[model samples]
Target: MDIRFIPQAEIDKQLYNSCVHFATNGSLYGYDWYLNATAKEWDLLVEGDNYVSAMPLPRTTNWIGRTQLTQPVLVPDLAVYSVKPLSPKRIQAFWDAVPEEYRGGGLTVEPASVPKNAGRFEVTTAVGDALFLNKSYEEITDDFPSTYYEQLARAERADLLPVPALKPEAYADFWLSVHGKSVDNEWKYHAMQRLMYQVLHRSWGNAAGIQTRDGQLLAVSFNVYSHNRIFPLFRAESKAGGDAGAMTLLNDTLLRSHANRSLKIASEALYQRSR
Candidate 1:
């Protein structure tokens, strides 16, 4: 068996086409888009003749964070791999080949059975989502106290915060500091950043940072966009003070702006773990 690394962008159309054909008839979620989005950060492993596999490598440093709640490990799309049916031994061997540094991180494996002309092909898909927030804004805000709205109104009247906008480059150091807090894992940082980028680029999402009256960053929140539905992916507050209420205020303001629409708020899984 020989293992070859191919840039994700260079993968032949036939391979993707094949995957799509199988995906259409398979139970996999987001299969078609997954196959199409495979990029240079992904790899394909081939055995003697019939078996094939696709693996995704860590492509960014957003997953790592000092605080468990702040980490980006749960964003559903980090490192993943898709493979045609192979024996347990081959599967184990394939994982064994991964560099030790990358092997022990947030790697996940999912297996699917796809029927091929020759016979049956087992497709193993692996990825990780440390936290997934897909609920509407109302669902998200339900967790906070009712007084939160009053505080948000105050903040807005005082002009004490910046509007949440997509500021990818502005938060570089903030992201790095969060990543540095991790004890052993570094791959998480990449996942975190990817999640942030995905949210920022989506027309349905917006991100903003909150600062204290003294101009210190108090928290950051990613608000989902929708006419009648809203979701909050990541919402965090600085550890320097007991201003947890600030986050609640941020959410209140967001909800008020979209009060005309039905809203659901969701948070990363890590948020619950941290609390």
Candidate 2:
């Protein structure tokens, strides 16, 4: 139950890598190769002989002399990554091990591994979506709302075909055109999102794209995979793609292609609006 906050440089990379490498709930977000690009500093948590968890804390200072730790963009949930699925007691123990200052700034972790009723900190939840391959691809297709099918068919008719992969920069350009150009906030996170592309480019994942007949990019899909799960980290579509459901068709195409892998898409964010 003892936790030590060893600085990233001082931490043993081999042991830490092994911790996440063998973690039951591991994702690319927990890996150094991926996290290092976005986070400057992180602390490893150790329980006796084992490196149990790692926390990447990206801190910033304001002109008003206020400094605070914030979760880096492209990293959704990276609190304490444990080797085992976090139980209530383990989650509490892990937090108790974390220093109080580090605790207050709020951290996010995967919904599946989250600790319920954490002590004294106000908690919030965001609903997400995933698709599992327990059923045949055809059966899974049946589960898609009639609208998904309708839009997908329309996209196909318009010749928005799914290709196995696309360039990260191409995807970013399209993403910015759709989200950043249209939104008032201007999606300041696009920089971080693009950095994620470089990180993931070296990792075990695949990118898919939907394009017009002349090869104009419509939508891009970047999904990272663990042993048996796929995390649909980010997917974006242009207005034309959105109008024709290019993204939906792309996702379905991905599922159908990978259906033989017995993979489950563990998404906390569902693709479509729920009625």
How high is the CA lDDT of each candidate model? 0.42, 0.64
**Superposing all C-alpha atoms, what RMSD in Å does each candidate have to the true structure?**
10.4, 3.4
Model 2's TM-score against the true structure: 0.82
Which residues of candidate 1, in runs, are more than 4 Å off?
1-72, 76-160, 163-166, 175-180, 183-186, 198-202, 226-229, 267-275
Per-residue lDDT of candidate 2, residues 1-275 (tens digit) = 56676766787777777787787767667777556655655555665466765544455445765444556556666645667656766766665565555544555666544556555443344346566777777877775667777887788789777764666666666667766664422443455455556646667666778888888888787777774777765667888888877888877777677775678776553445211
Q: What is the TM-score of each candidate against the true structure?
A: 0.43, 0.82
Q: Cα RMSD for candidate 1?
A: 10.4
What candidate 2 gets wrong by more than 4 Å, as runs, is 55-58, 62-67, 111-122, 181-203, 269-275
Q: How far is 121's C-alpha from truth in model 2 (Å)?
A: 4.4
